[model samples]
Target: MRVAVFSFPGWGHLRPLLPLVRELLDRGHEVSVVVAERFAAAAADTGARVLTYPSRFPAPVPEVRTAEDLAQVVVAYYEEAFAALPAAWAAFADDPPDLVVEDALSTAASGLVADRAGCPVVRAFPGFAGNDEVPLNGSEPEPGSPDLDAEHPAIAAFVRGLPDRLARLGVGEDAVARVRARPPRANLVFVPAAFQPRVECFDGSFAFVGPQPPADPPPTGWSPPADGSPVVLVSLGTSSNDNPGFFLACGEAFAGTGWRVVMTTAGHLDGATAAAMPPEVELHAWLDHHAVLPHAAVVVCQAGAGSLMDAFGHGVPVVVVPQQPDARVMARHVAALGLGRCLEGPVSGADVRDAVLAVAADAGVAAAVAALRSAIGSAGGAARAADVVERVAAATPTDGGSQSAWR
Candidate 1:
């Protein structure tokens, strides 16, 4: 079988899918991946033929301060990204693949391509699958407030512009709606069922496949300190590490506490800030999370899905300081699950210290982590995701629709 995969530019979106792509290749299927030029090299490492495209919009500004700011960022990103769909389809015009697999956020573009080619498309959720049962992007609706009948002005404007944006690509407004509303043959969710909000409501159309293991090997020359103090790993994820204040706060919180702190800046931290960190803290631009997670007694992070799920996989509790709405939702869920505590808004070093200490002292957190770890282990990570893909490809009709059991 020949498969084409689409993903957004961020590592959070690309990393989860690589393990599945590699699994498909190992099974003798031909795979091609379409992603931003920034991720071309990383995608190629999966052994899939890689196709890179350019975006008209500039990368999202890291210092997103408000929900409005984030919503605008989403609109700009999709507007620019979907603009590239025509060229992407033209590249495969002569030789279309059997199926299209894409991250959930890439639905607009990938959906258009699948519709044009008349092939079944699989939607993969690397994090939360937004539905009526759960709040979108981790935003909680105010209690006693009526649901709005109309979309937000910014969002409505973006929706209105969709037709003009993809008109050149032969995707009409109705086609776009169908792509957005049409359910996938298989909805591959990369978190365990226990981690999902209101998991009982979702039918078999969704598979609660657990987190994919890191495709890369563990970092070399890194070992846990032999000191008996507990280890705290701090990271802000790759896309949103622009906040030096958070890192500075962490340094002050754990300084001289006998606990070893390993912080990853993802190359966003400045030299002056790094030099100012306390001697008890070790700062690096990046480290193998899979290698560091096992030794961590508690994780201090921004609650990105990949990092949060990885901590759970290793049975380590977390103190989540979410920087975005989606991450705020994950952090809330973590606190609700008894797996960790959340620091919601602008926090300080003392806030970080208190949350970390609270999580460390909570015995229940350990038990919760252990339960989630077992659930994740049994959810069939990358291998199960591959099985679903193969099944969908075999069962889907060539006329561009799917007749899979889940559908």
Candidate 2:
């Protein structure tokens, strides 16, 4: 089988899909990955054919606070999708992909590719999958906060205009309708069903495969401190992680605490500032989580779905300080699951220290972590994701023809 995979530029968006790509390749299938120029090397390292497109926006995506901001974000996401279409088409021009694996948010790009190839698609969700029973992040917005379901006129206008734009590109009505349909042909959620909210609502169409670890772990040249103190890994992921205060607070929190702190500042801190950090804290611009998680005893992070998965996969607990609404929901889930602690609103160095210490010492949290790790093991990682992809591909006709699964 020939498979084509698509994901956004960020590490969080691209990382989860690579392991699945590697699995497909190992099974004697051809795989091609379409990603932004910044991510091309990582995608290529998986041994899949890499197709590059220019990124549409600057790094550290601006926070979305207003309806207009949300609309702008939608526009930028599609812009990147459209930019990616040509490279994707060219890479599979002679013989189109039999299956297309998509990052859940890359709907527009996936729809266009599937429309052209007339193939089945599997949407990969890095986090929770929502239904009528819950929102996408798997939790309800706080009272008076903007509900994800609420329709803002700006966002509505963009959505309303999509059909016509798709039409101009020769995407037929049937194809558009199928792409807009709910409960897609197959949804490969990269989270265990045990961790999903209201798990009863999702049917067989959803395969809750937990996060896929790196097929080939990257080298980071990092190791635990020789003093043998427990290690804490702190990161806020690639985007929306420009909170200097949070990073500084973390530095202060672990200072002189007999804990080895490894942090990924993502260049949010200047050289002088980073150099001034406590002797026990080591800061980097970026480091693969796989290289750090095995040695980590605890993680202090921003509650990103990918980050949480990395911690849980290793049975490491977390102290989540959410910086966005979606993250807030995941934070609650962490606390509810007894897997970690959630720190809400503004926090001080002392608050972070207290939470990290408290979560680390909690016997109940350790048990919950063990249970979730077992669940992740059973949910299947890359191998299971490959099975779902092959199953969805098999559902297509043998004559290399299309079906309603991806009209």
Candidate 3:
């Protein structure tokens, strides 16, 4: 069988998709991963054919000073991603694929050709909120409840722009009509089914594929102390580490403590930022997450699903400081599930140590982590996902125009 996988630019988005792709390759299917010119080599690590497209997105402007700025940043991601679709199709002119597995956030699979090729398209939801329409981050003054305002600035922009973007994609004025009329063959959600406990509804073509990490974790450049001074990993994810003040605060908090802190400041920070004389701080641009999770006593991060899920699988407690919409929602679940702790606002390193210890000290937290890990282990994960792909490839009917969400 021939399979084509499409991934977005960021590591969070790319990470979850890799395990599933690698599973397909292990099953002996011919696979090709379509990615940006910058990420082709990274995608090729799975041993599949790497198909590159010229990505127009700038080095992710991860610093969100306000709601309006985040709105603009998101729109830019879509525009650049949208412009690359036709070219992606042209790259596959010779032998069209049997199936296309794509990032749920990307609309590339909607290009008229892939459907015309009579192939099934399955979307992989890597972050929080899979295919749901209702926002899950309602933990504040409740946009519908109390602590938060009744406004979602980011979602509103995309909703308003939907008509214009659809027209630009040649979906016509009735694009929303088409969305209502035609969804996709199936959606393969990569997170566990229990994380989202919501009252609202969404398109129902989604599946759960559990949490999966690369079979091989990377080797870290630094090692923990032999004396075992509780090691904690402090990361703001790769993109969100643009804020220097946050790192400064962490530097102050983790200083002079028995805890050994390995900080991934990302490429956004300068070396001078670490000059505050904290001999215990180890800073680097990136760490091979798969390589380091086993030794981690706790993880402090931005609450993205990839990091949270990895920690959960390893029975490592987490301290979540969400930086975006889904991040906040996911953090709520981490706390509610008793698997970790949640920090509501801007975080300090003192807050990091306290939260990490607070969550790690609870014996029930360890039990919950072990329980959830057991649940995830039975999710039929990568092997089941491979089975579904093979089944779809065999059953795909010729002639694609309009169909049900589940084909």
Candidate 4:
């Protein structure tokens, strides 16, 4: 079978799908990954055809301060997807893919492409999966809250522009709308079912097959301190690491303590700032999370899905500082599940220290983390995700729709 996988720009988005790509290739299926030029090498490394598109969706996207700014960022991402569609069509116009797998965050663009190709699609959620009870993309305003798009004009414009984008792709709005109205043949979520919010609300249409570890993970040149002090790993993910304040706070929080701190700056810190950080805090431009996670007693980070999964997969608790809406949702779940503590309002060295110490000592949090780790291991990761894709592909008719495999 021939499969086409569509991805969003960030590494956080593309990384989770690589294991599935490798799995398909190993199973003797032809695979093509649609990605921006920036991510071509990573996709190509999987031994699949790399379809490149011109995307101005900047990596380390500029920090968004308001809903309007965030809406504009959303518009930019959709526009990037719009640019990718023509290239995808040009490649498969005559002989299309048997199946299409797309990032759940990118469903609109990729689903429209699948509609034009007459192929079945499988949506992969690297983060939360939403339903009637809790919506993912967007939903009506809550109670007396204002309508999102109405209050945010850019979002309103984005909603209005959808039809035109479909028209340009030679796909009717109804065809794309139909794809959205019904769930895909399979929904692959790269997190354990235990981690999901309102897990009972999601039906068999979703498969919560936890994250895949990297095929060739970077070498861990890191080692624990000879003094045997506890280690704390601090990060703010790739895109949002521009906040020097958070890193500075972490440095102060662990200074003169028995806990040693390891931080990945992602090139966000200047020489002066790096020099200013206390000696107890070690800084690196980049480090394989695998290098630090096993030795880590606790993880302090901005609540990103990938980071959270890595921490939980290692059975280490976390202290989360959320930077966005989706992250906030993840933080809430972390707190509710007893997996970690969520920090709110203005953060300080004392606050970071307190939260990390609290979670690290809490026996309940450790037990919860251990149980989630077990659940993630049992969730089957990439192998099960591949099984779902193959089943969906085999069951789906040539018209690119299926009802038999709703898993």
C-alpha local distance difference test of each model: 0.80, 0.79, 0.69, 0.82
lDDT digits (tens) for residues 275-348 of candidate 1: 88998898888788777877788998888889988898888999999886457678888899999998886799
lDDT of 3 at 306: 80
lDDT of 3 by residue, 1-407 (tens): 78888887777777777878888999899988888788888899999998877776655444455555656666666566565565565666677887888776565433333564556777676754433354434243235322222245655665677667656555454433443355556666666666654523434455566777335565556566788888888788876778777777776787777877877877666768767637777777788776667778888888878888888777788888887655767788789989889998766767877887787788988888888777567656777667666765666355232233321
CA error at residue 208 for candidate 4, angstroms:
0.7
Q: Which predicted model would earn the best lDDT?
A: 4
Q: 236, model 4: CA deviation in Å?
A: 0.3
Indicate the TM-score of model 3.
0.81
Error of 2 at 287 (Å): 2.7
Clashing pairs in 1: 118-400
For model 3, the local distance difference test gives 0.69
Write down the TM-score of every candidate: 0.88, 0.88, 0.81, 0.89
Error of 2 at 392 (Å): 2.0
lDDT tens digits, residue span 57-83, model 2: 546565677656666666666566666
Q: Which stretches of candidate 4 lie over 4 Å from their true place?
A: 58-74, 137-146, 150-169, 172-174, 213-218, 396-407
Model 4 C-alpha lDDT per residue in residues 307-401, reported as the tens digit of each score: 99999988899999987545766787789999999997788988998888999999999999999998987888889999999888877256335
> lDDT ranking from best to worst?
4, 1, 2, 3
